[model samples]
Target: MTSLFDPLALGDLTLKNRLIMAPLTRMRSQQPGNVPWELNAEYYAQRASAGLIISEATQIAPLGQGYPGTPGIHTGEQVAGWRQVTDAVHRAEGLIFLQLWHVGRISHSSFHPDEGLPVAPSAVKPSGEVLIADWTMAPYETPRALETVEIPEVIAEYAAAARRAKEAGFDGVEVHGANGYLLDQFLQDGSNRRTDAYGGSIENRARLLLEVVDAVVGVWGRERVGVRLSPYGTFNDMHDSDPVALFTHVLGKLSDRGIAYVHMIEPRATSAGGGDTVQEGVPCSSELFHPLFDGVFISAGGYDRDGALEAVASGRADAIAFGRAFIANPDLPERLQKNAPLNPYDRSTFYGGDARGYTDYPALG
Candidate 1:
């Protein structure tokens, strides 16, 4: 049986451990430009012991911005800024991947140009609020539906963002298709009520996500591309009546593409923002859909050391990605190896904060 401490091959790269760092949005990037800076570099460098680090959900364009201070990869300055982060991680012998994101309808007009409404697959207002600058909360605005012809443009944007991730010195790119983001909006039925080629049936709903994966693969090839999905997640007010069928079909399509891996959120992840919305008795774990895909599978959400070890040992997942544990324990893998006590994370400073809960969390001595 493969232990969490053993190295595993993830596409073209080999991770030293199976404790991958899930993408976490700290909202500490530089203002106005929304670029990663030296502080961001230090933040990631401290936790470089993970098997892999997936950078926080980074917007591909200005219109994709949902919250303030989240980083972007669409500009020369932003790419240059991320170079520092990649360099820091690489210096610690850590592999890093950037997560390409677009918030879709889970956004406010304040972050938009001319205060325009955010765009989505359809005009649906999510039942939640978004954080702007300085941790200010605002209700979500009804988003403008994207025109059919403009779909190709958004696909191209993902391709461009993938190229920029390479330019920023990342080892790979994970398309953020989870957490009710743009691609998830198109993937789920609740947010997507369109009559075009991009909605209605399971195949249509999955069209945008596959197109995005294809577009990014065109730039980075299949080996350096991965995708994240939340099959039973209700975050940002997202839901699909037949999540198992929907995700199985989508994962099957991704298998044909030969992507590096599929990072899936567990059903327990649905409690975010409000309460659980996943139907009872539903098969939502990644283990149920493992055979449908031909690549590595990463299971995330509320995983502890024993749980993570069991998942990999039982062949349920090839790896496990930890979120909050990683936030408080920079040397998470090391601490887990010895079963050492972990530092508690301050929830108040989770978003839009300085180095307090961002980088000052000390690793186990």
Candidate 2:
């Protein structure tokens, strides 16, 4: 039986264990530039025991930003800021990957350059409120559909961000195509109602994501690039007429590309008031799509130690990613290894806060 603690080959690097730190948006970057600072460095360094730490969702360009204080990889200052984080993680003997992201229709105009409307594959308004630059709730506005010619610009932005991640000294990059964000908005039929080559059929809808993946792979070879997907995700009101068909095609395409790994968000994570419960009768991404992906497969969302062990041992997933658990337990791997009780995380300081909840979680003595 494969143990979660066993070393596994993930692309060119051998992860010491299969416990990955999922990319979490803390929204604590410095204002004005949205650059990561020393505080962010300390937070990541404290979790160095994770097999791999996927940094918070980072916008690829100014227009790509959706939330206040989320970091970016587009500017020199942003790159420099991330360098501090990468350096600290490396000094702590940890490997980290920057998750390249762009939240399309998830944004309010205040976060866009020139206060322009957020862009998506179609002019659809999501059914939720977004946190604007001022941290106020604003209803999602109908986003501008991207001109066919404008898509190349989006692909280029991803490539550029991958290069910046490399310059920032990250070991690799994970394209953020999950959570009903820009790429997810393009993947599902409910949000992407386009007549052009970028939408319509499954192949067309998946075009942007694959193209973005290829572009990032160009910067960092296939071994160093991974993609995150949320097949049955309901967050941000995402849905599809045929999720299995859409994700099957997407997974098969990714397997053919031979990328490093595919990280998937289990449906249970998006459930109301989030917990470890899997929605009854909904097939898990690992159970449904794991066999389709030839390379490494990582499953995230609501996994306890026993469940993680079962998934890995049964070949349901190659690894498990922990989000909230890692927040309150910096030495989560060690704690799990010994079955030590985990410190409960404070929900109040989850987003945009100081060192109190960020780095104050005491490790096992």
Candidate 3:
């Protein structure tokens, strides 16, 4: 039986255990250039016991900023700032990967310079609100459609960010193609209505993601790259007409590239009351992906200790990423192994705040 504590090798890197710390956006970066600081280092270092830590979604360029305080890897100063974080994690003998992100239509105009509209594959306006700098939940704005000539520049930006992540000492980079962000906006047909080569068929929709992956791999090599996908996620008002087919095709392409791993967000049924019907977009089993991709498969979203153990033991997932659990318990792998009680996470301080809920969580003594 494969236990959660067992070591696993992801590409050229070897992880100590199967419990990975998921990329969580705490919105606590330093303001001037959205740079990471020592405080962020301390927070990640405290949780270094995990097999691998995927840093929060980091923007690849100024045009990628969706929310305030999220870190960026584009500038020299930002690269230097992240060096502190990677050094701290390394000193603690932990491996880390940076998640590259671009928000696309899941953003507001205020975050853009000159109040320019956010960009997406198409000019579709998603139905929902976005969390901005001041903690205000503002209505979504219709994003400007990207011109075909400009697509290569965005792809190059991701490649540049991967180089910076390597310069800052990260073991690998995970492309943020999930969570209704820029890549997801293009992958799903609901938001992408472009008639050009970048849209229409599933292959066309997946083109940008594959291009970004190839670009990043060019910098870090295929073994040091990963990609995340949310097949049935409804967050940020995202829905794919055919998730299983779309993801199976996408995963097939990723397997051909021989990248490191694929992290997937599982489905959680939602309802207003006890008798209300569950939301229609339930996801297929993670086991279905095992044969499709020839690399590590990680499943996230509302996993408990026992459930995670079962998933890995049954060969459904190579690893399990704990989001909220890791937030409260810095030593989550230890806590899970001992079956120790966990510290409850404060809901209010989840997004933007000082060190109150950020680094103040006490690990088991």
User: Which candidate should be chosen as best, given lDDT against the real structure?
Assistant: 2
- Which residue pairs collide in model 2, if any? none
lDDT of 1 by residue, 1-365 (tens): 98888898988889999999999988899877998999999999999999999999999988888888899999999999999999999999999999999988877777765848999999999986778644688888889999999999999999999999999999999999999999999999999999999999999999999999999999999999999988888778888888888998999999999999999888776654233233446455777788789999998887878989999998899999988888889999999999999887777887787999988888876
Candidate 3 per-residue C-alpha lDDT over 119-218 given as tens digits, one digit per residue, 9 for 90 to 100:
9999999887777757688888888999999999999999999999999999999999987889999999988998888899999999999999999999
Ranking by TM-score: 2, 1, 3
Pick by TM-score: 2 or 3, better one: 2
Cα error, residue 57 of model 2, in Å, equals 0.4
- Residue pairs whose backbone atoms clash in candidate 3: none
- Give the better candidate number (1 or 3) by TM-score: 1
Q: Which 10-residue span in candidate 1 carries the lowest summed lDDT?
A: 271-280
- Sort every candidate by lDDT, greatest first: 2, 1, 3
- Taking all chains together, each candidate's TM-score versus the true structure is 0.96, 0.98, 0.95
> For candidate 2, lDDT tens digit of each residue in 1-365?
99999988999999999999999889899988999999999999999999999999999998898889899999999999999999999999999999999999887789875959999999999997888988999898899999999999999999999999999999999999998999999999999999999999999999999999999999999999999998889988899999999999999999999999999988877752244455756668899999999999999988888999999999999999999999999999999999999998888888897788999999999
Better of 1 and 3 by lDDT: 1
After superposing all C-alphas onto the true structure, candidate 3 shows an RMSD in angstroms of 2.8
Error of 1 at 258 (Å): 0.7
Error of 2 at 296 (Å): 0.4
The model with the greatest TM-score is 2
